[model samples]
Every structure is written in C-alpha cells, then in structure tokens.
Target chain A: MNSAYPHWKKGPGPMNSISIAFASGKGGTGKTSLAANFAKFLSHEKNVLLSDLDVEEPNVSIFFPENEKPGSSYNSKITIPEVDLNKCTYCGKCAQKCNFNAIAVYQDKISIFQELCKGCGRCSNICEAGAINLIESEVGKVNEYSSESLEITEGILNTGNIHTKSLITDVKKYRHRDINIYDCPPGTTCPMVESVLDADFTVLVTEPTPFGLHDLSLAVEVMEKLNKKFGVIINKSGDNDHIIEDYCKKGNYDILEKIPFDRTIAEKCGRGEFYYDDENYRIKMNNIYNHITGKIK
Target chain B: MKKIAFASGKGGAGKTSLSMSFHKYAKDNSLFADCDVDAADAFLLLEKEIQHKKPFYSGLKYKIDENKCIQCGKCADSCNFNAIKKTDKYYIEEFSCEGCSLCEDICKYNAIESRSNCCGELFISDTVFNTKMIYARLIPGEDNSGKLVHEVKKIAHEQVLSAEKEFLVIDCPPGIGCPLMAAISGINLLVIIIECSQSGFKDAVRLINLSKKMKIPYITVINKSGLNPDIDNNIEKYLADNEIFSAGKIPFDKEFVYLLNRKKLIIDSDILSGNLKNIFSQIKNRIEMEK
Candidate 1:
C-alpha cells in the first residue's frame, strides 16, 4: 500500500538551502541590489550563493570586496555549423533552406556567418551532402567565488556573441547546492528564461510605476506558465505609487515585501558597498527571505 | 517617414510616458506603435479604443488523431521539445510545443496534422487624440513575442505610409532582448529612458551598448532625475564617456500619476502642457538631426 516514490512524499523542507531568483522583464529594476541584499540576509543563518546571471553585463562582482576571486570558472561552448569546403557542393541548398539567413551562397562558394546563426541546425539538416557540421564555439564563461558568508557565481557572455542562453544554461549547472540566489538578466527573453526556469520560487522586483506594472505582468505571466511560486517586492516603495499594488490586487498576487526609496542605499551601491549592513534594509530583506523560505518549504 | 523608438533596458524607466507625450507633441499626423507586446500600455495613456483586432499565429501545432494512431511512439520520440507525452493515450502539451513539425514528419501512420495556435491579438486603434495607434496583446503563456512586435511595426509603418504621416513613435518593450531588437530594427533614432538609480544607470549602459553595436543613433533621457542626485551624476558621466547625448531630463512630477490615472497624455494637461511642449520640441529637434 506504500507509494513507490518516497521522494514525492516529503514536501520541500525549510530549505536551509533555497534559491530565490530576483528577475525583472526589463533591466534596471534593481535586481542585483535586491539579490545582493537578499543573499546577505540569508547568509546570516545559512550558506548563501549569489549568482549574477546577467552574463552580458555582470555587476555582482563590483559590489563585493576587491580580494574576492571566483572559487572556480567554467566555459560554455555552443555548436555552430562550420561548412567543410571539400564536402560542400556549392549547390546553395543550405543557404536556401536556412531560415535565419546565416548561410550565404556566392558565385562559387558558401559562407557561414556565425553572428547570424541561431544554432538551430536547420542548414545542417537541409544539407544534401552533409557538408555542414556543427563545431564547438566558445560563447561565454562562468566564474564562481566564495565570500565570507556566501558563494558567488557570475556568468560573462563574450561581447558581440548572440548565444547568451547557452551561457546561462552553463551557469545553471553550477547550482549544485541548495539556497542559491539567481540574479536574472533584464527582459522577458531566452536568457532570462534560462536563468529562471529551474527555480522553485521567484521574487519579482519592481518599482511602482506604469512601466514597472507593465513589465511585472509579463514576468508574472512567465511564472504562471512555468507553474512556479512567486511574490512581488515593491522596491523604492515610498514613491507614492499604487500601480504595483493595483496590479497585485487585480492579479491576486502576494506582495511579500516593500523597500522604501532610499538615497543612502543608492550611494552605498554606487560605492560598491553592500547595503544589507544597514540595519533597516537588512531587517526588510530578512523578512523577505523568511517569507520565501516559508512558502517554498 | 521618420521612425523613432523609445527603449530602455530596465523596466519602469518611463519609456511609455515619454513616447505618449511625444505622440501628443508631434501633433503632426503620426502613428503610435506600442511594440511591447508582453505589456502594451501606451494605449491606456492615450485612452484608445481598439477598432480592429487580429490574432497572431507564429507556427503550426501538430495534433495526433487517436483513431488513426498506432502505438508506435515515433512522434513522441522525435519531438526535441519533449512536448509529446506517451501514455495509454498520446497527447501534446500546447505550451511546450514549439511547432517544429518534427513530430508530424516522424509519424509513420500520418495521424498527426498541424494546426495554428493563437499566440495573441494585434490591434489597430483610434486614440482619444484622434491619432492612429497600433499595438498587440500577448496571451500570458504565449510565445513568439519578437514575431508579434514585428507584426505591430508592419501595421504601424503601413498606417504611416498611407496617412502620409511624418513620424512613427514606438514604445518598445524593456530590455535588449529579441522583442526590443525587433522594435529597434530600421528605426531612425532610439531614445533610451533612464532613471536615476544604480540599476537604472547600469541598464542604460547595457542598452546603449546594444544600440552602438547595431549602429543605431541613440540618446539618453534620465527620468525621475531628482530621486538620487548622485546616481544622476554617475549616469551623466557614463553618457559622456560613451559620447551619447543627454537629450533632456524630466524631474519627478506628481502630475504624471494624475495624468495616467485619468488616461490622458501629460501634454494634454493644461498646467503641464508648456513643460511637455518644451520637452517635445527638444526631442523633435534631436530626432530630426538624426534623420
């Protein structure tokens, strides 16, 4: 009469190890600051890992001390189709079949532009003679570091490369421990999706403005589709705006926490200082950490 | 025709407000395109009524006929997205289906047939200001946002050409992702709305970097400039370093909330009209030079 799957019997625990992802549909909603402060708050009782998933523009490293070096680093490579000239027939079929226009056929040769390629393998699949083959192309790097109270992992996409999602996927591989915090890239796109897809819970950091309400709805839609638990945190709360609150009510979303707009917090962040040390900010972030942990557990 | 896009990497940076005000100030026959399909709200500010709606279908979804199915499991095995689940009865989860048609190609019994899935609806509307606006609404779980933005832009461009309009103001989706990229494609100029906050400045840099790479002429507008004077200074320095212009700074104004709540453009307010008029004139000059 016992169920075959014992793992399913036990619900999510206090999750002394939990990963709270701070993501926004658009950039500059204070995801990193919220992420860093949340990490600092959780570090008080558990080992925290702050992962900066904005591979294109990593800012988590700037907020930490100068002596910190990532504990380890990993490379992410994407397979881009590289045509073998000897095998190519110059028939122009690959170019004709490619939907992304990555392949081009000239008078006597076929050229592959890696930048335009989506790595979709359409051209390779369409090649009649199997002239096109995918080769490993290094797209980005993931760096891991350990701080006094937490571990940090950051992904850096090689500038001018379009394969950000692949790099983000590589970064997720480092989430070996529980209680991880992911700092998602701004925007509702493939890279953001890559960072957030695996999280058990997400914290949508937003300001109280029309634009904030607009993008928060998009992020909320993504969470709902993924069937992941989430709550809203109104950063810069005292702006005297009700757009977010109205949205929360309309959508039946929980408002987990609110952080008032403080210039000191901004100054500290600009100076590369952790603002979580500030008693007031720490208290609010701790409440958020506890709330998320409570729900996930 | 002049096409200008208002984009910001970070959300809540005032792209919509600025775009709406520009649409009002231009007063020259113009088409407003809300290219932020995920959350199209420029219409809300303009109090527009959707006059026409069209469903957007990105690709076709293959449906397997249970009557014709032989338990071969080839269709499930061939799906790269793991969209098909094999059980007593085979089925496809619409959300996971990318519409690659691999399942249809692999089905030996010819049981699978492809059908279009409705991602969202695109709208052509008439605003209270009497201007034509093009926008889209994406279903919560819809895919192909980039495709939707492209569709919206196409309609907006057609409207502009037919009306002999002088401008097309696009309120782009936040972030430099596929949707934002699609919104910026073929635009004459990009106005990046930046807020005076640490993350705001950081995102502005990211968006500007993307604009530079795309070879799109762009300028920065620091919204809510009075919030953090220090952060504003940092953004100015960053813009200077990048050789981008600080088009004009809009101070934090309570009237913005009032205007939005009333579903009216800021330029339409009698008290704020002068200020918005000046701001629009400056933006128009800058955009004209870029053209």
Candidate 2:
C-alpha cells in the first residue's frame, strides 16, 4: 500500500505524474517559498498538490491563510499510551517495557512525557497488569487550502513536540495529484530523510555560501544512500560565490537554475508575496519545471 | 559558568554569524559548542585542528542475518518501518528503518538482530581566538540527534566547570524540536535570532513562547534587520507585546558572508565591525544582568 508515501508511486509513472520534494540541508535557503511558488506556477497548466513536510514550523500555510469559507482541514494524531489510574499499581512494568523511555515510574507515580512517546504500542502489548491503554494524541494538524485547480496541504506540528517524522507521514496521506511537491525540513536528519527518500525526484536548493555548500554535500550524501534521482538548485547566486558552483562542477551534479540575489525579491518575500507572479521568476521556474520533467521522462 | 545559547528557529538566520561576532568582541574567557550537530558549520569557522577525537555511539540499528534467513516473510511482515525489501532477499534499508526490533521479535530463525553503530564523531580543539570549542558531526541518517546535542553540551559544560570558563556560547540548531530544546535546556541566558521573513517571524514566535513556557531567561537579536521594514517592525512589535527584550539589530549586509567565506571573524570585516561591537556590548550586558 502507498499509504505511508501517498505521493510516491513505485517505479516510473507518466512523465508529468511524479512527486518532487524540495529540500536543502542548510535551512533558510528558500525551499518553502520556491516550492510554494513553483507549485503555484505549475498549477496554471496542471493539477498540483503541494504538501509541507516541515511540521516543526510549517510556513506554506502562511501563503494560503485560513479562508473565510474554509477549505477542509483535520488533525493528525498518533497512538500514545494512557494509564488507567485505578488499574495502575506503579508496577514499573509498562515503564520498563517502553523502548523510548516515554513512561517512567518513580516515587509511586507514573510520569508520561508525551514528546518521547513513539506510539508504537509496545508498552501496552507488554503490560501484564492491563493498566496501559493506547489512546490517540494529536501531534499536528493538517490544513488544506484549495483554489480552482491547486491544493496546498500543510502539516503544522504542535509546539514542543518531537514526532516530526510522524507528522510528515500524516501530511503525505493527501490525495495524489498529477504533480506533488513536498517541502522538506532543513538538515540531513530523520525529518529530511523521510521526506525525500520515497519521492520520485528530489530538488536540492542551496544558496551561494560556505554554509550552504557544506550542508549541501551532507544532503547529497543522504540522497546517494537512498538511491534517489536528485539535482541542485542554486538560490541567491551572485558574486562572492563559486563555493557551491565549484563543488557541483567537480561532483558532476546538474545545476538546475540560479536565482540571483536581488533586493526587490527579498523585500517582496518579507511581505509574503509570491515571486512566481513576476515575469523573471516565472520564466526561470517554468524552465526548472521543464528540466525536472525532462529528467523524469 | 554562565551558559548562553544563540538559536534561530529558522536556519540561516545568522546564529553562527552572531555567535562568532560576539565571541570575537567579548572580553571574558569563554568556551563554545556547536550544538547543531547534524549540519555543524561552526567547525568550519573555527578552522581548528582537532586536539582530541572519539567515536560517538547512540541508538540501536537492526541487522539481518542473511546467511540464516529461511526466505520466510515473518520479519518483513512485522517490520514497522517497511524497511525490509525483498529484491533478491529480504534486506533492511537503513535509511528508512527506525530499528524498532519488532521484526526481531517475530523472526522464527533468529535471522534478525539488533546492533548499535557509531552515531558520529566528537572533536575537541581550540579556536583561532584561543577559546576552546566543541563540535560534532552526526552520522547521516542516524536518529536521536537530541541525545547527540546533549553529549556535546555535557562535554562543554564539564570542561567549562573544571577550567572555570566564565561563559559558554552554543550555536543552536534551527527549529523548535528536540535538538533545539536540548541546546537551550539549563541555560542561564538564551539569545534567539530572527529575520524579517514570514517563516522567520512565525518560527521565532514559536521559539519565544516555548522559551517563556520553559521559564528561560531570553532575549531576541534581529538578524538582517533593515532588509524589510514591514516584517521587521511587526516582529519587533510582537516581541515587545510579549514582554521580551530586543537585544539589538544587525543590518542586512551582503558583506556578512565575507567572514563565512574568509573564515575570519566580524572584527576583520570593515562593513560589519562597527555595528557588531555595539550589538555585542548589549548581549554582554544581558549575560551579566542574568548573572
């Protein structure tokens, strides 16, 4: 079943029916804006589904604020252990059974730290006293924004929660459209791995700086391990660069597009305006979309 | 020792830049730790040779005994991660595998086993400024980065206590997640960096609320402040309404990347040196006030 990776269809599908995830090992390189704007640009000609997997601080929803009439939205909850107070004897059995240390019995009391709970049901299965029960806990909310032909579904994680991967998995459950773009979290960690591993294509975005170059290599290493087809997108490329360009050249990686650093673009971004509406960014993104589609085919 | 952490809920908001600038201008003898282990770029800024090194081990990984596998599908059926693949044989894909060990419990022939691998390596060295620095690199795809961050902080704290360093500067990871929490926990002072972008404002607000909830003494430092007056003003007003102090603002300058490219500190940059000194003074004063 494709429930775990709803956007990903195994093997090759039609040329334009592939899921592409945008990521950068270094954060704040404009992955969310680029993905959001590109999906908007692509939606003009096709059905586009943009999913935000950066649950810790989902920003895609900002581009599509809550509508007055409201699009469909729901909560994504996971199974966490609940203890029946009368049945609980402070036996430490369920606490010992949890592999994540989500439950610990101390001072004849049960303290459950929900952030650490993995919702694997191991504790309830191992509890012999019938004291532990598996109950649903809301880790994040999945909000959907729909227009004439586009749908943007974003997973906003509950603050101070640790189940980032689970929230990403929940967001990926959105109905598959012809083109799906998943905006992944920064850093080469579990969250990034989960977002890009199953996608048909991954677009690596980076700025022209040392920090971007260093982290881009780490992210590239992860894609190599996952055996995914990926390429690099250079953002804010200007003079005082060549760090990333040299690396990409030497590494034999494809350089998709370079969006130069401009004051107008940055200011527009600060005001929550989409760059794709501009003729310049529109032309560039159109080419980028064509390039990704060409490679997929 | 006074523990001060610089964190930006959104990455690339200049946490490393601000920390490096403060370290350059501060007077007190201090220790630094790069708690953003997953993508630790502060190490590159230090340009220091390792004085000591060791392998870090954390979390368990499931390994399949291919030789003993009976070609049955029990392990594949019970795996929670769907990491088991049956290409030629049932092999575990490490990238997707969470190592839950449910497959090991169901295997009839003991074909599955749990083994721990090296999470990454830790390095101990002195920065070009002569301050001791601790940084770590997480083995890609390894989970429990919060634990790695904790180990990095533990080493820095222990070393600072024995050496009597007056302060510890931590370059925290972006986002309000486990690793970020680990970096800020037990801190005497927390410096949150925020930019003027939409996500930056949103994430910074989340971080500020979490800091207040945890009862941590905190201040905000605006990075790339002058680029967009609208978002910047809104963020300043939001922080003010929340009763949080804005330490200072560092203007948006393309030359800020000079130090990152040259591997030098802000003091070396004519473009940034003047304003950086004033911002560093405010941060220093705040740390002393906390003391």
Candidate 3:
C-alpha cells in the first residue's frame, strides 16, 4: 500500500526543501491557526505538507473540510508486555523487576495497569518460566491526506496514553514531502521538542501579553539550544501592545509577522471557515509566508 | 505561603497573563515558579538573569558494549518502546527509549550499561521584579516531565516558606498530561484561565472537572472577553452552572501590548492598575471567603 509514493523509500525530502515548524510554549496561542494558514499560504507556491504533530489533540483536521482524507499512511504499534498464566510459575519476579510499578503481583497471580505501563517489557524478559510475552499494542494512527493545495498528515495519539514523542516519531517516518510545516504541541516539553527538533526553522506564535512573552522566551531558548533558525509571530497582534516587540529587541529576535487580533478571524474559525474564505486574513498569512520563504532563500 | 497555580487544560487561554498580573500585584520577594517547565515563560516578563542551573536527569539509557559479543536479539526484543532496532548491527534510538533498563537486565552477556540522560535544565533566576523565579526546561524527545515539574514546585515552595512570602504564583503548562497534574498537586489555590472559544470553553470545563475530582479549589478568569461577548456570556453561564466563582473578566485591550513591550506588568500601569487592584481585591476576598 505504501508503494504509491517512491519518495517514501528514499527518505524525507532534500535539505533544500526547508521544514518550518510552528510552535508555542503555552497552549491556545494560535499555533494551529498559524500552521494551518501558513500551510495554505505556502501551498500556493510550493509542494507543502502540513504535518500535525500534536497527536494528543489533533485539531488540524478541523481546519479542512469533512471530505478531506489524509493520503497514504501507516499504523504504528508499541510493544506491550503480556503474561501467559498457563506457563506461569507465579514467582513474582516480573512484578519485582518492573520499575514503573505497572505490575502488581498477588499471592497467586499478577495484574498489569496498562495506563502506567511505559511498555518497557521488563516483566516479559525477567519471567524465568517464559510465562510472559511481548505483544504489539495500538499506540497511534498516522493519516496522510492531500488537498488541491497541500498534502496533510497527522498523528493521533491514543487517548489515555502519555507517550506522544514516540507517536510523533512514527508519524515523522512518513514525512517525504518538501516544505513541511509541523504544527507542534503547546509547551516546551518532550512532545513539543520532538515535533520541532528536526525542522530547519521554527515560527514561534505568541500573543502580545505578559504570558505570551513569557512562554515565547522559553520556546526561543529551546530553539536557540537546538541551533534552529526561528522568528516570532505575534498573534492577536494589535490587541495586547508592544511587549512582544520590546521582547524581540531585548532577546535579539525578529518579529516576522503580527496577526492582528481579529474578531472576524476567530468567528470564522469557530464556524470552521477556510483561510481563503477570509481574504484579508489570507493576505496577511501570505505576506508572512513570503517573508519566511524569502528568509530561507 | 499561598501557592496559587494558573492552569487551563486548553492552550492559549491566557494562563500566562493571569500569572504575570498576579506576580505584579504580589510583587514582594515572592517566588514566581514557571512550573510549565515544558514551556516556562514567566522569566521572559521578569527580565531575569539565571543565577543557578542544574541538569535534570529523569531516566537512564542502556548502552551496549559491542566488544562483549552480545549479538543476542533478546535485548532488542525486550524493549517495548521500540528503542532498540536490529539492523545488521543493533542500534538504540535514545529518544525512543523510556529508560526502563529492561535491555540491560535481560542482556545475558552483560554488554548493556545503563546511564542517566539529561532530559533538560532547571533554572533559579533573579527576575526584574526582584523576585526569585524557579523554572525548568525539558529537552525534546525526553521523558519524566512530571518529575521535573514536581522538583521546581518543591523548590518554589521551599523558597516561599523560607522567605515567608505571601504568594507563590505559578504559570502552569497546558493540557491534562503529567506536567499539568504535577502543577496542580498540593497547590493552595488554582485560577483556571479560559478563553471565549468553543475549544477553550470545552477545555476549561475539563480542567474544572479535573479540579473538582482532585478537590482543588479553583476560580475562573475569562480573558479576551471582548472577542465575542456572547461566547463570553455562554462561558459565564457555564461557570455559573458549574458553581465555579468568576474572578474577573479582562477585556481585549490593545494597551496590554504596550505594557508587555515595556516589560511592565499591567498592574503597574496607571490606566489598568485600578482594574487590577479590583481584581486582586476580589482574589483576596475569594481566598478569604474559601478559608
């Protein structure tokens, strides 16, 4: 089924096809909106792929119409330790060796709490009687969908699970297109980092409030440490004030774009309006897209 | 010390704004902890200088000594995280590993050695507000964010108690993940900031539900209320329906950016100080009322 795309076997696109990641340390800062619009803007000129790496809450699909389906895809699995009671000696070694306390050994048998399980498989390995085995558990689903404008792929992390980085890594295995725009999860943690780490550039979306400045700095620090090129996009731009610009000056970062706080835009989003439907917002996004492409070129 | 955490399950709702405003209102030697270590941002507003930093180690990585002649696929097969892959030669992706040490424990040839990976760094910095800010950073593709959140909160609590400060205001991370849970653990109070949007309202409801389940007393702060006053009304109605107290509503103000650009808190501005004072007084009354 994966044979339709030959580039999938050749490894991700060439280095010339710059990858831009839209990230924010704080949630609700318009990272997804920026990513969706930026993808729309870039699709006009380049072969773009909008990879929604925010697996925990995949919302990028909401930006598109209901008919849109992610193109070629793959299902990823993680190893879950399973115990076979028939071959069990009930020695309690598996429970004792498990560090996460996922396994509880009673007098006669053992129980495993799947939520707390890191899928380490120590229990199966330590089972002296070969009573335990490793089983593949569905952790996430990766979907690749294409539109007339862009190819979109997203990873949906299974609910009640915490291993987002692994799921993101699995989804990234399918990133074979150029000009990839990764919509990263909010926060400066493992999952967010996993989404933005390999990208050639990152666009930090923040509002011009105290909190926005605060989180933007953290995201900038992460990008700086990773040595990835990044710029700031102040969402709700004209609403807050100049704190973001002052922050840019102090931090030596540039304000790539300022998206004014538009009620129409929010209303459109709430109503599920596409980017092109709002011509003014689309123009703004296009300018930002051009700015990014110009910088990269 | 009153340790109040500003948290919301939904991202971009204005948790940072409330925390920053609270920091401005209670600006006396208090410890401002950016417990949203995954995205610590309070330091940016404070213009703080990092005074001390320490690497946070969460889990271990198992390194195989190839010289030990352990081509046994047992270790590779033992890891559930898919950290290990057999490709002619055995290779382990450090980011994928959960540091379970199962590979080392199962290696019969004693070739695997487990070592801790520095997930990120924790910083104790001096902010422009003259307060000590406690924050941490989690490296991308690393685990144990809950542990890091706990460590930073502990440090903030210790500082607050030692200094006899009035408040330990914290900026919490987004979502209901381990980090958010850790941020909410053992806090004196929680202020959930909710934006007036469908997803924001939904996430705020989830946060309030979680707070009730955890028995954490919380209040609501609706930001960007002017974006759509009707939506704000619905959120207010939801809060009323849920019996959650409303702290105050911050109108979508353009001047907020002016304050931010100047690196000044809104509470410090003459125009917004009166409103901020009213909000702080309400917060104080709410806490006292709860007590």
Candidate 4:
C-alpha cells in the first residue's frame, strides 16, 4: 500500500460524502484520462466511484473491460406526450403552449417530435381534449461496472437523441455516498453545468495552448458564476506552462498539478493503457487528490 | 450553395484547425460559420473585426413575487424540474427552470410572471481572409445551444445566398447531441475529423452513425495519425470494413500546435502546409463530387 495516500473512512458529518467533477470547456484536454487515473489512485486507499456523465460521448467505459461489467443496467426514459387523435379536437392550444416546438398542430393532423421534447409534461396537462398522453420513451441507458476496488457508472445516450441533460441527471442518481468523481462533458453549456452542480469541488483540466487558455477562461467564468470551488490542472505542459500558469496566477486559481507533454503517455493512453501505475503519474494523482481533500477540510 | 461542415465527436480532435485551414484555402469563394458557440476559437485565429452584433432571445423565464405569493406551494409541487424551492420564500432557480410556463399556468395568485430571456448574442464579422464569418456565444449555464446553432446557420445561409458564395464551411460543436444535429441538418457534406486514438475513434464512429442516420454524406480525415501504429491500423481497418470514404491522414506534428500558439494557421506555415493543402484539396474534390 502507498503510504502517501491518506486513509479515508465514511462517516456522518458535513464531509460525509465528497464528490469532485473534472471538466474542460475544450474536449480532448485529458479530462477522462485524469479523472480515471485519479479514481484509480484514490481507490488504492478508499472506495471510489467514477461516473461518466458525458452521455453524448461517454468514454470512461473504453478504459475498462466489458466482461467485468456489473449486472446493474437500465433503460433511461423521459415522459413525452403522444397525441391520441381519436378524441382530438385539433385545437392548436397545446402546440402554442409547448415552448420546445416539439409538437405541431396542422389542419388535419398533429406531429409530435420526441427528440425535441424536454419531458416537461405541459402538453399532456394542458390538453383539454384529452388527446395528449404522457408516455415513457427510452432516451438512453445507464450501466454500472465494478473492477477491483473502483466502481463505475456510465450514462450512454442514444444517437439522434437530444435529451442529454436529463440523462445526465439520471446517471447522477447512482453516485456513491462515500466518494464520487464525475467525468463531465466538454463545453460550458447545460450538460457541463449539470455535471458539476452537485460536486463539492471541481478539477478543470486544460492544455497549455492558446485554444486551451481561451476555453479555460470560459470554464473559469462558469465556475465563478456557479460559485463553485475549483482548481486547475495542466495536462500537456511544456514550455507553454506560463500560458496557463500566468492566467491561473492572475486569477488566483490554484494549479493542482502539471502532467508533461510526453509522447509515450499519449501513445499508451491511445491503446487504452493508463499510466497512473507509473511512479510519476501516481505521485501526481496523489497530489491532486490531497489538494482537493485539503480544500474540503 | 453547398454547406460543408467539419465536426468530430471528441473535442480537440483538430476540427477548428482543419476547418480554418480549409476556410483559408477556399479563399473568398466560401463563407464560414463557427457553430461551436460554447468555445468559439475560430474568431481568434480569423483576425476578425466585428461588423454587427445582435442579441439572441430564446424561451421564457418565470419569477415569483414573494409579496403576492401566499406560500401555498402549488407552483413548487407542479414544477417538473424541481426549480421551485422554499427557502424562507418560494423562488425559481433560473438555471434549473426550463421556462415551460407550467408554474405560470398553475398560479392562481398572479404571483408568477413570464418574460423572454436573452440567452446570448450572435456576431457577423469580416475576417482577414476577406470573407464573412458568422458565430455566436451562448450565455454560460444556458441550455439553448441548439437554438443558438440554428440562429447561426440561418444567418450563414442568408449570407451565403446573398453573397453568391459556392460553399459554406461550418465548424460544428463536439458530441452527437442537439447542437450538433442543428449544425449538420441539411448540410451538403460533413468532413469528419478523426483523431488517432481509442477514445477518439469510438466517438468518431458515433458521429459517422449520426451523419448516416441524417442522410448527410460525409468523408473522414484522420488527424494526429501515427501517434500509435496499432491504434492507427485499427482505425484504418474500421474505415475499410465499413467501406467509409476517407479523404486522407495528417501525421502528428508539433508544428501545428506551435503555430496555433502563435495564433497562425498551418496553411500559412511552410513545413506543414503542403500535406494539409493536399488533404484539403481531396475534401474539396469530395464536395464537388457531391454536386
């Protein structure tokens, strides 16, 4: 056992369950890699649950084997209104009341687009003619996996589906009560915001480039707007560390750790091989974990 | 006009860099739209000067007047999103409130009022390449990105038609979600940028599936290739097995990142421009073949 890891036990208090989310406004900034590695590192000493909330493009499962997948899986559904045209007075009132434009009432027929519906149930409630019925429609599925000491939950959205935000909410229901880490979707929009909303702290992973800095600033704006406690981690650090370091310094944001731009690590990650087992990466991951727990304290 | 877009399921897969290069190579013949409104970096590389800006108004938000509210908790019970909460007083959480107006309809006290919300702003700008560019920035924490993307596409379509441009190149947001659907709808061609990695290839396949489902013709270009020979070969095998058409591959080069640090496009650089130009020409040929 690594002596560097602090022993964590579940207890009743304000610090009963600590959850942290890793987010990046820019994709491919190593959010998944860093989150997965951190989960593995923390699991060495404490039970950890790593959840992939990037329903649209959930990749956390890629790092784990499928045969070891747990039996807990269920179809995620949303209540979408379907028109029962038999009793229909083709009043356009329900159509007019729907803000998402998911329904359209025409002269002879009405069309209900399931993808546009946010499952608000307003249409069914407002349908005075009793033509609209709220039905459970499958939007995606949630699966849980257990490997070694780490537990994994994945929210996978079906292609052509638009209810990414709702599916993420369903996935969060599986969060472990002791320690949870969420791998968030890229961008500062609703999906990313929803993933990090309940987290006690957030780790913003970014590269050391102009594009990274620009998007990092936007993510910082989101964290600040949400009044969330967060720290920064530079993934592909090189001579360009100052690009992010300077920004973090100016904003008074804490820099947790910097993973250098090593080709070997990239290639290994490309093959679904994680480097947290490496002595150097283990140390870095431990440092980030300690830093977060320090903040919570 | 033909609308061609550069998109990938994974972020930082070199979508913006390649789309910008294609924009430069297309010269004045094409207009550009950066549909990745969440983090629009194309504007930074375009050396753009804003010509016009307009507010993007979308959806409605309800606010409760505490003085009029009797604390009956009907609105809170009726809200589907759990946006209404009682903490000293009942209030609507703007971020969680989807503006479905259910509370307003259920309120008997007239305490709840609805108003249109300004989610973001769109910009029409002139780029250094002497072509028009369309982009927008969605207000953080707002979920109206698909609507914002639609607005960008509408302005771009009008601009392309009015200017008589032959092609419209759009840089789509990552993921196969609503915003991406809005960007690729009715587009003539989708240039899928596939990064040479396990996660990257998996996400790209999803994007390709979405394109096929939408009946939009697409061609793949492998970026960051040669990072791992095994992974690269596997990607090639997948493309071949699926009979997917690929424009070409771009080797992993640090020069591209170096140039981007300087806020310069690879097309303007001497070392990497040759390979990129060749790949982009193949993309152009694919677009022409569609016509």
Scored by lDDT, the top model is: 4
TM-score of 3: 0.77
Stretch of 10 with least lDDT, candidate 3 chain A = A1-10
Model 2 alpha-carbon drift over 4 Å, by segment: A1-16, A65-69, A85-93, A106-108, B66-80, B84-89
TM-scores of the models, in the order given? 0.83, 0.93, 0.77, 0.96
> Which pairs in model 4 have colliding backbones?
none
Residue-by-residue lDDT tens digits, candidate 4, B1-291 = 999999999998999999998999997789999999888889998956999999999988888987899999998887777789888889888777778998888889999998898989999999988899999999877779999999999999999999999999999999999999999999989999999998999999999999999999999999999989888999999999999989889888888888989899988999988888889899999899896
Ranking by DockQ: 4, 2, 3, 1
Q: Residues A164-248, candidate 2, lDDT per residue (tens digit)?
A: 8878877786567789999999989899998987698899999887888899999999888888888899888888558887898
Docking class for model 2 is medium
Clashes of each: 9, 0, 22, 0
* Model 2 Cα lDDT, one tens digit per residue, B1-291: 899999878888888888876765663568888999889988787746788888998777887788889989877775545678898888888876765565766787999888887889988887877778888999776788998899999999987897787888899998888899999999999998988788788888888888988889999888887777878889888877877788778788777765667767766688877777877778889999995
| lDDT (Cα, tens digit) per residue for candidate 1, span B210-290 | 888889988777787776577778888877886878777777666776576556677777877786677677778988888
TM-score of 2: 0.93
- Between candidates 1 and 3, which one is better according to TM-score? 1
**For residue B115, what is the lDDT in candidate 3?**
75
lDDT accuracy of residue A294 in candidate 1: 84
Best by DockQ: 4
Q: What TM-score number comes out for model 4?
A: 0.96
TM-score of the second chain in candidate 1: 0.91
Positional deviation of residue B240's Cα in model 1 after best superposition, in angstroms: 4.0
Model 2 chain B lowest lDDT segment of ten: B20-29
- In the range A192-245, model 3's lDDT, one tens digit per residue, is 877887787789998876667767877887787667788899887774547788
The top-ranked prediction according to TM-score is: 4
Interface RMSD of each: 6.7, 2.4, 4.2, 5.9
